[model samples]
Target: MRITLKCLLMSCSLLIAVDASAQIPTLAKCTRSANLLACVDADGNAYSVNTVGSTIYLRGFEVIGKRYWAQTSSRYGQLTFFTGLASDGEAWVGYSRRVGWTTINRFSSSGGSSAKFTCSRIAGC
Candidate 1:
């Protein structure tokens, strides 16, 4: 009976750890100004977005190297879609609107992860 209890506790602990690691981080209190969007995640990690010509770039937090996203929408559209690949070859896709939130997804070899930010325009974009 003691052996069975020990095994059950160990199994439960392992399951808990896996669930915690699978959680996706979220960004809040985002502000957009001109060509840049700044945000802070729940864990207090900072992230920013910038546009150079027609390419969009995301930096900070889990980013390990510079990656540029290609725009996939018409310039006249209210919403924009972007896709890119991380330095480590992870696929990323994101979308945002002129007056709403932005959502980004990363497809990694070990499953995947995502982040959503509540965005507000600040002017001069």
Candidate 2:
């Protein structure tokens, strides 16, 4: 009985781990072997960046992506961004194929580009 219980617990843990990894948004071509060029801000919210060697992590309390891009905040009329698009003209593009390491500013319907830095390690590069 104990062995069976242990097996079940192990299975559960494995399942949880898989789910957690999927929860975070990651780039396809952003392989660890590649070099991390840039790390963007997270929608004016809390975010952290820890880089060791060539691994850069853009961790947030409720944020996940290859990178983050911070923008104007809006409690009642502020802007924000989700996994894909920006809420009210805000976005955090961590890893992109065509653009490479870039943080596009989406302040409005016409979000301008502050900079479009490229990362050689990225897939497209």
Candidate 3:
């Protein structure tokens, strides 16, 4: 019984660590420029987002390539949803923002990826 309990605890701890690792880090900082919102994630990834009328334009600078997505926003009460396709039309990206929390989702042939972050504003960029 004792050995079994120890193994179970170890398995639980390993599962918790794996689950935490799968979570994406929040955006570290953000700044506004006119209609554009620029931010950097805790992982040092950079993003530029702009909204004009109902359309949302997102640009991301990743380690390998630059990605651009253009989506439209729909508002339900205080929540706004942005959904659209990538520049090349090979994938789709969606974003939802409520209050100061934002969730981003990307769907592609490989799989779907997601991240959650707090939308924090900083002065002096």
Candidate 4:
């Protein structure tokens, strides 16, 4: 009984860790491509992105390499964007747009680049 309980606890902890990993997003990353800055999905698909210094800004993201998406800390109270996503040698960026300010929370590494991103100007955010 004791061993089974310990195993259950360990499995539960591992599950939590997995869930934590899933929460990360990759809106930023370094790429070997041109155009100075780029964002990539975890599978290795790369997209051009705009960055300032160390942080990827709210703008400069393009979908299908055309329409650009952007956000600003001042203008929009809340915002959300894509990060690199990779799995099994495939890369893609799942996109979402949210705007409004809200509380910033801790970020995870494997959560993807945008996982460390911010959203401001939330309605109740």
lDDT of 1 by residue, 1-125 (tens): 11111111222111111113546634356788988877654544445667666555555443223332222222235555554443345554445545443322212122255544343233211
TM-score quality measure for candidate 2 = 0.19
lDDT of 1: 0.39
Candidate 2, 7-63: lDDT as tens digits = 112211111111234566433121233333232222222333334543334332223
Model 1: lowest-lDDT 10 consecutive positions = 8-17
Q: After superposition, which runs of candidate 1 have C-alpha atoms over 4 Å from their true positions?
A: 1-33, 51-56, 63-79, 93-125
Question: After best superposition, candidate 2 residue 93: deviation in angstroms?
Answer: 10
By lDDT, highest first, what's the ranking?
3, 1, 4, 2
Clash list (residue pairs), candidate 2: 41-70, 67-94, 74-78
Put down candidate 4 lDDT per residue, 11-72, tens digits, no spaces: 11111111225667444345543324444444343334344443343323222333333321
- Model 4, 21: alpha-carbon shift in Å? 14
Ranking of models by TM-score: 3, 1, 4, 2
TM-score of each: 0.33, 0.19, 0.39, 0.21
Report the Cα lDDT for residue 95, model 3. 41
Residue 78 displacement (Å), model 3: 11
Residue 51's C-alpha lDDT in candidate 1? 67
Which residue pairs show backbone clashes in model 3?
none
Please give the lDDT score at residue 40 for candidate 4: 48
Each candidate: what lDDT? 0.39, 0.27, 0.41, 0.30
Tens-place lDDT per residue, model 3, 2-56, is 1111111222111111124556534347888888877665555555667676555
